[model samples]
Target: MSMARTVSDTRLIFGRYLRQTLRSKVAVVFGLTQPLLYLLLFGPLLTRLGGVRGFGSGDAWQVFVPGVLVQLALFGAAFVGFGLIGDLRSGVVERLRVTPVSRTALLLGRVLRDTVVLVAQAVVLLGAAFALGLRAPAAGVAVGLLFVVGLAVSVASLSYVLAMRTRSEDAFAPLLSAVTLPLMLLSGILLPMGLAPGWLDAVSRCTPFRYVVDAARAAFRGDYATAAVGEGALVTVVLLVVSVALGARRFRAENA
Candidate 1:
């Protein structure tokens, strides 16, 4: 009964948030601009380095598109906390606190909405990539999207938790920048870490995003059984579990 209630509540909250997102067609289109720019501008340059070692195992499109997808998930979902902070300021969260909604549903619903948006943006990005010459197998692209979903859920949940803690965009924005910038650089989301110096490469291995990027790239190249895929899947699952748990706990505590 509790599980059913949570599912029902999650669907209700997801519908509410998803409806609000649909109302802003401009926001949806603009969200793709950054990744699309990377695909259009930075992507062509990668073609020049097609033969470069450590650029990964496929054409420039394969390597570059996967990295751009990861970047989309990282930058896109990481900023979602700004909306939550807005809600907090406008008393939206406070109003929800008095409702009988399940706390887990509250977090899951928002996360689901985020995951849906990210997936749609990803499809658009992939369509553009195809037009520009990307040609990965259908199954591989599907698997890569699974990674994106995991990434979206993990990052959005944590963003919400962080927003609730800081409860101020002033504090949240700077802190997020500090964290995301390093993660982006170290995770090899632009170029492969293989191109990095040995010590730098070793350090990148310590970051979970690095493994996920490697896995997504590997999937894009049709290398599904590789160690990189396993590691990325494991890291994504662990991160997803931990972040969702933390977000739900924080929501309950805040509303309790």
Candidate 2:
């Protein structure tokens, strides 16, 4: 297919899903609830520990808000497969498979919709964080949100691939939970891994999310040139490329 054609198809698919999402205004608002809860309930606790080293150089909100944004992206994008699974069970995918849409567009359109929803939620989370006294350079917050976009794309693409493979909500839910819980804890989304024991911190370093979290914190501190930022950007690019490739290939196979 021509690139133009593919782009058109992607836009069409994206518009369809986005409209569906926008119609349910409550979902968009409710989506921010989890991160907001953490900001309201858990964030203040970090205020007292602001003097503690390894929580990053900024105030507690600075260190913590970035982590929560990442958490929002990590958890929010991770389970998007549930929607895909529903589409599969309801014959949505079966219907699309017979369409003339570019196979890559079929995947990209869905992932892009997910990316938009996640970025919006991240913005709302940031606003709440600001109201609650989180402060960071605007440029740094923008960089952090860019990271959220990359993470959302990577995770959501892989999620769609998994949903297609399993095709069963019962099996998919447990399997996804088993995988995401570990990634969440190890990624230091709620607390700095610096607070972890030596062995635990070492293990966390092995997770790609650790670097991403560290990068966001550094960015929030307005230190953009740091090694953490470079590493996180590199990891995000690598994961995004790999995951999108796998997702596109799966879409092609399924639609073939």
Candidate 3:
């Protein structure tokens, strides 16, 4: 009964945000533009430079598109907290605080909305990638999309928790950048970490995002049953659990 109530509450809140998003068609278009630009401009250049030492398999888009898709989730979902900060500043969160909705639902609704938006953006990214010579199996693309959603859930939940903690976009931006940049640089999103210096490659192994990128690459190669996929799934599950727990706790505290 408790779980059912929370699910119902989450559905209502999700519907509210979904309607707001639909009312702003430009948001949909612009949200995907960056990834599309990378697909168009950067993708071909990588293909041209496939002879470089760091390039993998010479199927450049196959290598590049998975990274770009994960990059899309990395940068996009990590900053979703900005919206929560806006809600707090405008007293919107406070209004919701007085309601009977489950605190978990409050956070899940927003993260779920982010997940939906990111998935849509991923679809656009995949389409552009296909047109640009990406040739992954359909199952691989579907699995990659699933990973994107898992990533969205984890990252957006943490973003909301950070928003609740900092309560200011100005402060959140720097802190988020500090974390995101290191993760991006070390995760081999633009290039495989194997090409990095031995020390740098060793360091990247410590970052969870690298596992995700590797798993996506493997899936792109149609290696669904590999150890990389298993490890990636494990990391994502752990991340989602931890992030949702922390986000829900913060939301509950705010309401209390």
Candidate 4:
């Protein structure tokens, strides 16, 4: 009964957001345009900038492509929290607080829906990348799905942090770019981390996105290294926990 109620409540919230977003033509365009722009522009541009080191295969754009997809999924999910922050400031959070719906369910549900959409968007981008010579191994589909899952969780958590901690969605808007841009820049998104400056490589080592790239590349190749999986799982778990913690605290404060 409890699980059922939770599911129903979450579904209600998810439907609400999705409906609103879908109704607005501008919103749909903005969301789709992100990956499309990266696909059309960055695909050829990076491929043309000569050879960049690969994770292992040295295919240049191939290794770089997965990271870009991860970045896109992360950024795409960021807007869900922007919606959350907007709702909160406009008293939607307060309204929901007075209802019987679970706060965890409310936030988690949004994350779930947004993550799904982001992953689907990534498929389009990855397809475009392949057309531009970014070929994955035969296991590309499976690999991409796994990578998107890890990415969605990480971004959803970070988005939770943004929505809860920041004063408003507008205030948090620029920070989305701030957070994601570095994750891509530091990670082997456009070039192998080995080619990056020493400090940058060290920093990328600390960034979870780097682990995602490593694990993803391995997964794409069907290599499935234990070390890579462990690292990615660790970071994903830690970040998601932190997000829930912060979100809980903020929700309490808002209702208090």
Per-residue accuracy of model 3 over 1-256 as CA lDDT, tens digit each: 2999899999988988778778987877786888788888888887876767866553777788988888889888888889889889999898888878888888888888888889888987888788778999999888877777788789999989888889998899999999999998898988887689989988998998888888888888889999978998898889889989998889888442
How does model 1 score by TM-score?
0.97
For residues 116-135, write the lDDT of model 4, one tens digit per residue.
Answer: 67766777777776787776
lDDT per residue (tens digit) for residues 154-205 in model 1: 9999899999989999999999999999999999988999899999999999
TM-score for candidate 3, please give it.
0.94
- Deviation in Å, model 2, residue 211 alpha carbon: 0.9
List pairs with backbone clashes in candidate 2: none
| Clashes per candidate, residues 3 or more apart or on different chains | 0, 0, 0, 0
For model 2, the local distance difference test gives: 0.89
Model 1: colliding residue pairs: none
Cα error, residue 255 of model 1, in Å, equals 4.9
- Model 4: colliding residue pairs: none
The candidate scoring highest on lDDT is 1
Please provide the root mean square deviation of candidate 2 (C-alpha atoms, Å).
Answer: 1.2
lDDT over C-alpha atoms for residue 7 of model 1: 98
> Which ranking of candidates, highest lDDT first?
1, 2, 3, 4
